[model samples]
Target: MRFTTRVLLLQLLTVVAVVATSTAVFIGLSMAQLRDEAETSALMIARTVAAEPEVRELVAEEAQDEENPPAEELAQGQLQQYAVAASQSTGALFVVITDQNGMRLAHPDEDLLNLLVSTSFSEAMEGREVVAWERGTLGESARAKVPVFAPGSDTPVGEVSVGFERAGVFDDLPRKLLFIGAAALLALVIGLIASLILRKRWEKLTLGLQPEELVVLVQNQAAVLDGVGDGVIALDTDGVIRLSNGAANRIFGILDSENLTLADLDLADDVVADLEGGTARDGVVANGRVIFLEARSVDRGGQALGSVIVVRDRTDLMALSERLDSVRAMTSALRVQRHEFANRIHVAAGLVEAGRMQEATEFLHTMRSRGPVDYPLVGVELITEPFLQAFLGAKSLEASERGVSLQIREETLVLGNVAEVEDVATVLGNLVDNAVTAAVASDELRLVEVTLLDDADQLVIVVADSGPGITPGADPFAHQPKKLAENDQDSGQLKDHIHGHGIGLTLSQDMAQRRGGEVWLVEPGGEKSRRGAVFGARLPDVMEPDDSVNYREVQEEDK
Candidate 1:
């Protein structure tokens, strides 16, 4: 049923219940009141008749003499006549007078005259007045019995009985109930009208949405919000969080989704203000994850309803982008090497065709002595591992193109292969690229030094450049501003856009930290250290094989 209809029905039932209960109580009380009034009037009439001097004297005479004649019983007849006149005038059913022995002296029914009363008169004889419901010869009535006292005496000589018919006593009730029923009916009609009005108002309040529609809306909202990977948060105009999806709750680290606001989450004020203001913020970090944020204001009929915030996590996308950049750099270096090798081959071919056979042989010998065409750098050969050798050679080519000399330290010694080549590559790639940039910008001869060490438990990488060291009072590893570089176009976006400026170092540290390792500046760039800022990365669980264990085994056996 529609909500308004249900409300109307509920109100109707409530009013009916109240009216019915009230009517029942009122009917009972009214009936009792009317009956009591009848009894009181009857008692008053009886007492008045009994107080007459002539009636009391006659009753006293009748109690003294039992035998009497119709013609001689003049005083007794007078009392009977008076009672008949009183019964008629007062609208009583009947009025009777009896002696102390309970024999009637006067009765409305002439045939019942001079006979014992057909109802109890014991209380009246004992000098007490009584009023109650009783069935006599006159039928059931509200009757009263009072003692007939003589002049100037409290003692009773006889008794008077007065009765109002039971039917007559309830005659006014139907009329009274008619009024009551009419009032109740009118009240019910008014209540129904009020319920209908309230129903219409309720319809307007709920925008005419039925209970079933609201149910469907809730179900659909849950389905859409919970099924999507993106986080959604809806807030009221007052900035109170009204609805939060499962993704939002999980992303914001909220323990409870209800009755929460952005302030409750202790978010940065600028972020909260931006969200409330319907401004979009991109690449925000929360709970150690990168989030892309979009805010939209919701309005209906030109009224501001609230705002909705959509959040997309960019952490994985950023990692993938970083890997792609590394691959692209490698590809670029390979292209350069291929072009250089092609030139050398062309020269050797030309030399052979020109009849300079000895020189061509010498050139072939020189090229062979130089090892692989891809491994152009002499210092890179110190690291015999093919992947690092190629990676460093590629970086060397990239550095040389930028007028920066990139070289591997002579003391660098890594015997076994790196366990996780990607991790080492990512950290080393970022460090080398950043060093190259710093070196290229320096006034002195651009030079960068790279050192690689595998100490059985960790792979340690250090990169130092001959350039102006880290800026004063700046933390390269910490969060930095996203201010656009003066050469944003030329410099391009770094491998880690999430970290903004100095992204290379920040992302390198993040990647290193993820592998139970750390990357930090071992030395800031200054005169104190000849090499500019020297950064070191210690990656755990990524080391060459344990050759020392085998060496120890051999030594033990010999012993």
Candidate 2:
């Protein structure tokens, strides 16, 4: 049920319980008061009738009947008349005078004069006032008995008994209780109906939102994000992951929610620390390969609530950037080739105008021999323009200038697409440049080896150099500047301070990741005296069977 409905029902039930208890207590107290008042009124009437002078005189006349009362029978008749008058004066239902033997003498009803009095009258005649229920010709009644004594004597002559019908006192009580109960029940029904109506109205106003709405909203948002190709991960202030898009899950190979955490995504330790420390930070990763984690404080109305971390996958963007760099390099090389070709045509035109046929033929032959041709590597015909080849050749020469021997190992068995030829050249160029710089200070054999091989389902390009391998203890991709001095033979503490803080491997690694691949430093062997860094790149194989044959023939023809 909706929240509003549940709240309304709970409130209605509480009101009902309270009203019921209160009504019950009121009815009980009212009945008790009425009962006490009825009892008191009955006792007062019994006492007043017993104290009547006629009652006293009747008792006296009866006592003296044995001595001087045959002539006084007329006086006794007058006393009996007075006793009847006293019974009428008290508003009791009935009054009877009973002698010591429990026999009625004077009664409100004349026909009841000879009737047997109740046992309660006998108890009263023995000097005790008695009150009890008794069955009479008129049904049951509450009877009170009081003893009458002779004038100025303590001896009981008879008992004056008074009765009041109990039905009258109890009659209105049930009706009043019924009225109160009806009111309570009516209030309860009205309250419940009001609660239900309000609940329905609330549900309508809220657009029928329930607990399931929250779940559905979240799931829908996640579904929309999952369609995106870029990885996205979000985390709350506690360093606990809140959401991860499909791309992110696949990139990290996180198939289960249980293994996801802030640390697993290569988020900066300080950023994680700040989240743990309740601070907010936002920045991009240097390489732009892994997710870039940025944290910012979440707030409401100027109050600091928590922090939110947004992760963006820059892998594809980085690849696009590398492709752009390759295009630029190719463009530059093509511009140079155009200029050189224009100069050669001008020189040939001058030779033909001077009528130097032999010399012009020699010049033509030299130009043809010097024309750019593609190189073959790893059985793959290098389909790139001559300008790119020249760029790589110049980079190789630069490495040699730095005392680093550039070696190229060609695999004769593999062929792959040249779609990324410019990009491959750029990547190799950068690696050779960095290797030359790193190997310049090494006392060991400074050699940079570029090897191409075909692995199952992919083409692997390995670049290994004889230089100090990446600092063994830390992450090879750590964001530190390149060490300026390989040997600590510099001036002072300042030299040591500036060493080992570079971004070469970090940059190269970022490039490798952009091509749907990775770069790793191969472990060195125990027997090998050379200690250097080895970087490898793996690209998807795009060579067809016919292309493989042509590529192999091209390499053979080159040989």
RMSD of each: 6.6, 11.9
Cα lDDT of model 2 by residue, 273-380, tens digit = 765664544323433443455566655455444455445665445445545665665665566556777888788889999998888888888666554322122211
Against the reference, the lDDT scores of all candidates come to: 0.77, 0.59
RMSD of 1: 6.6
Task: Write down the TM-score of every candidate.
Answer: 0.71, 0.51
Clashing pairs in 2: 480-501, 480-502, 481-501, 481-502, 482-501, 482-502, 483-500
Lowest summed lDDT across 10 adjacent residues in model 1 is found at 488-497
Worst 10 residues of 2 by lDDT: 490-499
Candidate 2 TM-score to native: 0.51
Error of 1 at 70 (Å): 7.0
In lDDT terms, which candidate is top? 1
